[model samples]
Target chain A: MADFFNIIFSVDFGYAVLRVTTPILFAAMGALISDKAGVINIALEGMMLISALTGVIMSALSHSAGLGLLGAVIVGALVGMVLAYFALNLKTDVILAAIAINLIAMGGTVFVLFMVGGDKGISSSLASKVLPRIDIPLIRSIPVLGPILSGHNILTYLAFLSVWVMYIFIYRTPLGLRIRAVGENADAADSVGISVRKIQYTALILSGALAGFGGAYMSMGYVSWFSKNMTAGRGFIALAAEAMGGATPHGAMFTSLLFGMFDALSNSLQTLRVPAEFIQMIPYLATVIGLVIYAANKTEQIKRIQAHQNREARKGAQEVKLL
Target chain B: MFKQKRLFELVRTVLAVLIALIVALVTILFASDEPGRALSLFLFGPLDSLRHFGNVLEMMIPLLFTGLAVSIMFSAAQFNLGAEGAFFLGGITATSVAINQSLLPVVHPVLSILAGGLTGALFCGIPALLKVKWNASELVSSLMFNYVALFLGLYLINYYMRDVDAGAMVSFKLADTSKLIRIIPKTRVHFGLILAALTVVAGYYFMYRTRWGYRIRLTGLNSSFARYSGIQTASVIILSQVLGGFIAGSGGAIEILGMYRRFSWQSLPGYGWDGIIVAILARNNPALIPVGAFFLAYLRIGADLMARSSDVQSEVVYIIQGVMIVLIAAESFLAHYRHKLVYREARKTAASGK
Candidate 1:
C-alpha cells in the first residue's frame, strides 16, 4: 500500500495519466458536441476504428503524417455524412444505423488492413509515420511540472487545447447556440427560424472529426502500429464520460482524465501479483460505476426540483384560499 | 389492406437484399483478383453440398435463439445489449454443469442447459435492475456489463476450471452424458435445431397471445400511455429483458454442447450482434425470425466457401449485412412506391363509390 501510494504520487504516473487521457478526451469532446445537438454519435467507436486504419494506410502511402491525419478526418466526416443520410434523410433509427456502422467497421478495417499489409491483425508491415512530440521551452525548464507536462506528443497537447476551443465554440458562438437550441427543443428552434436538421448535421460532422483526431492519435502517437479493434471500448467510455460530464466540454475533459487515470493504473498494475484480466477490467468497471452514480445523482436532482415545484404550487393554493 | 401492407414490406425487403448484393459484387470486384469466381461462389456455394447446407442449418440454430431473444426485448422497447455477455456466460455456466460427474445421463444435459439459461437471466438482470432502481440508461449499462461478464468469465475459466493438461485456456471436457445428440446421420447438425424451433414458436406465443406480452407491447409502443393505463411498465421492461436473456443463454449452452467437446471460447461469440440484425430484418416479429436467421446463415456459409476457394475474404459478408440492415431499417427507402400504390387504391375506391 505504501508502494502504491508512492507510485500514485509520482510525476511519472501523472504523466502516464495525461498520455492515456488524450484519445479519450478527444472522443469525449466529440460525444459532448453531438450529444449537445441532440444527436448522440454512437458511431464514435466505428469512426475511431476506421480512422485509425485510414491514418496508418494513408501515412504509409503518402509518407506524411499530416496528410494521414487529414485523410482520417475526411473519412470520419464522410462516415458521419453517411450516418446522417441514413438517420436524418432516410428515416432510419439513429442507434440502429450507428450499430450498422460499427459492424461494418469491425469487418471492413480488417479486410482493408489484410489487403494493404498482408496481415489480418496488425499493421506492422506497413511503413507508417508517427506524429512528432513537442517540448515546451518554458515548461520544460521546470522540475516536477516539466516531467509531468512537457515533451509529449503533439496530439496530446492538441487534445487538451481542444477543451478550451470547444468551450468557446459551445458557449459563445452563434452556431453553438443554435445547436443547443435545436437540442433543447427542435420544434421551438424551427419556429424561431433555426434549421434543426442542418445544425444536427454540422454537430455530427464536427463530432466525427474530433473522433478522427482521437483515432489518428491512437495509431500514430499512442502506438506506432494499427491493430484490429485498437480503439477497444474507449469510444463507449467516452459516451459515459460525456453523459457524466453533463455534456460539457471541460466537464468531459475532467471525466476523461479520471477514466484515463484508471486506465493508466490498470496498465501499470500488470506487473503486480493481480491477474492481468482483472486489472484490464478496471477502466471498464469504473465506467459502469461512474454511469450509475451519475444517473442516481441526476434522478435525485429531478426529484428535488419536482418537490420544490410542488411546494410552490401548494403555497399558491394556500394564498388563494386566504384571499 | 393488411395483405397489401405485408406484400409491400416483402417487396421492400427483396429490394434491399438485391441492392446489398449489388454492392457486395462491386466490393468483390475491387478486392478480389477473380471477381467472377468469388461472386459465383458467394451466390451458389452453399447449395452445392449437403454437408454445407447442414452447416447453414447448424449456424442458423444459435441465430434463431438470439434473434428471438432480441425480438422479445425490442418488443418491450428495451435496448439491452447484454445478450452477447449473457450468451457467453451461459456457455461458461453450462460447461461448469456439464463437467459434473454426479448427474444422471439423460437429465444431465437438460439440467446443464437450464443452469446456463438461469445464469444468463441473472447476467442481463443487473442492467435492468440498475435501470429501474437508479434510472440508468440500459443501453450504456448493458454495454458496460458485457465487458464485465467477459472478464469475469475469463477469470473463472483461468482460475477455477482450467484443465492443466489441455495446454490452452480451456475448461475440462464435457461429459458424454451432457453432450447434445446429433440429429442427422452424416452431418454435425444436432438436436438444438428442434429446441430452436420450439423456442421460435414459444416466443411467438408469448409475444402475441399472453396478457404480459400485451403489456410489453403496449409499453414499447407508447410507454407514457401504458403508464397512464395503469400497467407496470418497469416490471414489463425487466421481464422482457430477463426472458430475452434466458433465450440467449439457452442458445449459448446448446451451441457449446452441440458444437464443441470442451469450453474453449476465449472471446464473445458474435451471435448476439447477429441477433440484432436478424431482429431488424424480421421487424422484431418472432415468427419471421427463422426466415431472417436462415437468410443470414446461408449468406455466411456461402461467404465462407468463397473465402476458402477464392482470393476474396469472407468479411465481405459483413459489408453486405450492414448495407442490408441500413436499407431495410430505413423507413423511407421505398416510401414513394407504397404511397403511390395507396393513392391509386384510394382513387379506384372513390370512382367505384361515385
Candidate 2:
C-alpha cells in the first residue's frame, strides 16, 4: 500500500497519465463525432494504426513534426474514404466493413514496414524525428498547475480544443442538428430533406482526421519511434470511452481522462510491485467489468420501464371502469 | 434445366475463384515478382507434393469445423466471434488433457476428449450468456472476451505449463497414446479430418433437417416474425450459440491434438477469422463449409509457397482477404449487377424477335 502511494504521487506518474490519455482522448473525440452522426466507426483502431505508420514515415522523411501530423490526417482521410464508400454508398455490413478495414490496415502496414525498412515489426534505426514539447513562459511560471498544463506537445492542446469544437459541431450548429437528426431517426431526417449518407460520410471524414491525429500523437508525441501494433487496442478502449461518456463529446472527454488515469495507475503498478502481466491487463479487464455492469444496469432500466407501463395501463383501465 | 442451374452454380464458384487468382497474379506482377513462376507456384504448390497437399487438408479441418460453427451461430442471427476464443482455450484444454492421459488412467480417452470439448464450449458460453442475460452486443462482448481468454491462456502457460527443458515458449509434451496419429505417411491428415467432416454433416441435418433448426433459422431470418409465430426465438438463438460454441470448441481440440505434441499456441490461432470468411463464402450453407475451407486452405498454402519461392510478401494475401470479404458483404451489388446483365440479354433477345 505504501508502495502504491509513493508511485501514485510521483511526478513521473502524473506526467505519464497526461501522455497516455492524450491519444485515447483524441480517438474518443473522433469516435464521438461519427457516432453522433449515426455511423458506428469501428475502424478507429485501423485508422490509428495506419496513421501511426504514416506519422512515423513522414517524420522520418521530412524531419518535421508538422508534416507527420499532416501525413497522419491524410492517411486517416484515405482510410475514411474507403470506409465511407462501403458503409454509406455500397450499403454493406458496417461492423464487418470496419473489420475488413482493420485486417487490411494490419496486413498493409506490416507489408509497408517490410518493404521500406526490411523489417516486419519495427523501424531498425533511431534517426527518425519525434514531436517535442513546447513551453509557454507565462503558464510555466504560475505554479503547480502551470507545470502540468504548459509542457505538453503542441498537438495535446489541439486534442483538448477539439473537444470543445466537437461539442459545438454536435450541438450548436445547424449541421450538427442535422447530423444528430440523422442519428436519431434516418427516415425522419430523410423526410425533412437531410441527406443521411452525406452527413455520415462527412462525419466519418472528420472522425478519420481526429483518429489520425490520435495516431500522430502515438508515434510522434508519446514515443519517439514507431512499433508494430503499438497503438495496442487503445482504439477499442476509445470505443468503451465513447459508451461510458454517454456518447457526448464532453462526457467522452471525462471518460477518456478516467481511462487515461487507469492506464497511468496500471503503468505505476509495475513500480508498486504488481505483476507485469496483471498490470498490463488492467484496462481490458476494466473494460469487460465496466461493460457488464453498464449492460446489467440498462437491462434493469428496461424492466422498470416495462413495470411502469403495466401499472399505468392498469390504472387507466380501473379509472375507465369506475367512470 | 437441371444441368443449367448446376452449371450456373459451378460457374459462379469458378468465377469467384478466378477473380481471386487473377487479382493475386496481378499483385505479384506489380510487386515485381516473376509472374509466371509465382502463378505456377500459387496454382500447383499445394498439389506439388504429398506433404503440402496433406498440409492443406489438415488446415482445412479446423477451418471447416469453425466455419460451420460460425455459420450455425450466424443462422441464429447472433454474431458471436468467440469461436476464436473457444478455439484458443480448447487447444490448451486438449493439450492439458493429452498431457495427463496417464493420471486419468482408468478413464476412457473418449471421455477425456469430451471433457476437452466441454472446456472449449464453456469458453464460448460466457459470451452467449452475456448476450442472453445482459442485452450486451455479442459482437463486442465476444471480441472483448477473446482478449481475456488470450491473456488468461498466456498466463496459464507461462506460469504453470512452461517447461524449463524447452528453450522457448511451449507447453509440456503429451503421452504417446495422446497424440492423434497421422493416417497417411508424410501427410498431416489425421482422424480429425473425418471428425471435422462429420461435424459439418451433422450441422447440415441440425439446421435443415430438424424442427429445432427451423426455429433457429426463423429466428435468425426475422426474430419478430418468429416471436409472433410463437417460436421461442430467444431460446433458439441462445441454444444455437451454445451448439455453435460446442462445435468450435471441438474443432480447437481436434486441431491441437492432431497438429502439436503440446498445446503450444501462445496467441490467437487465426482459424476463427478464416472461419468467418469460410462461413461467408459458403453463404452460411453448412454443406458448403468443407468446400469453402478447402478453397481457403488451398489459397493459404499457395500464398505461403508463393512467398517462399518469390519476391511477393505473404501479407499481400491478407489484403486480398479484406478486399474479398468486403466485396462479399456487398451482396446487393452482385445481385444488382446480375439483374442488369439478365435484363440486357432479355432485351437483346426481344429485339432479335422484333
Tens-place lDDT digits, model 2, residues A69-104: 899999898888889898767777888788888877
CAPRI class assigned to model 2: medium
lDDT of 1 by residue, A1-323 (tens): 77777778999898999999999999999999888889988899999999999999999999999999999888888888888889899999898999999999998998889888888779989999999999999999899999899989999999999999999998899998999899899999999999888998998899889989999999999999899889988888999999988788888888999999999999888767788889888998999899999999999999999999999999999999999
Cα lDDT, all candidates: 0.91, 0.81
Across B1-354, the per-residue lDDT of candidate 1 in tens digits comes to 678889999999999999999999999999989899898899999888889899999999999999998888889888888889989999999999998878888899999899889988988888888998999888888888888888888998899888999999999889999999999977899999999999999999989999998999999999999999999999999999999999999899999999999899988888999999999999999999999999999999999999899988898888999999999999999899999989988898899999
Q: Which sections of candidate 1 miss by over 4 Å?
A: B351-354
What TM-score does model 1 achieve against the real structure? 0.98
Best by lDDT: 1
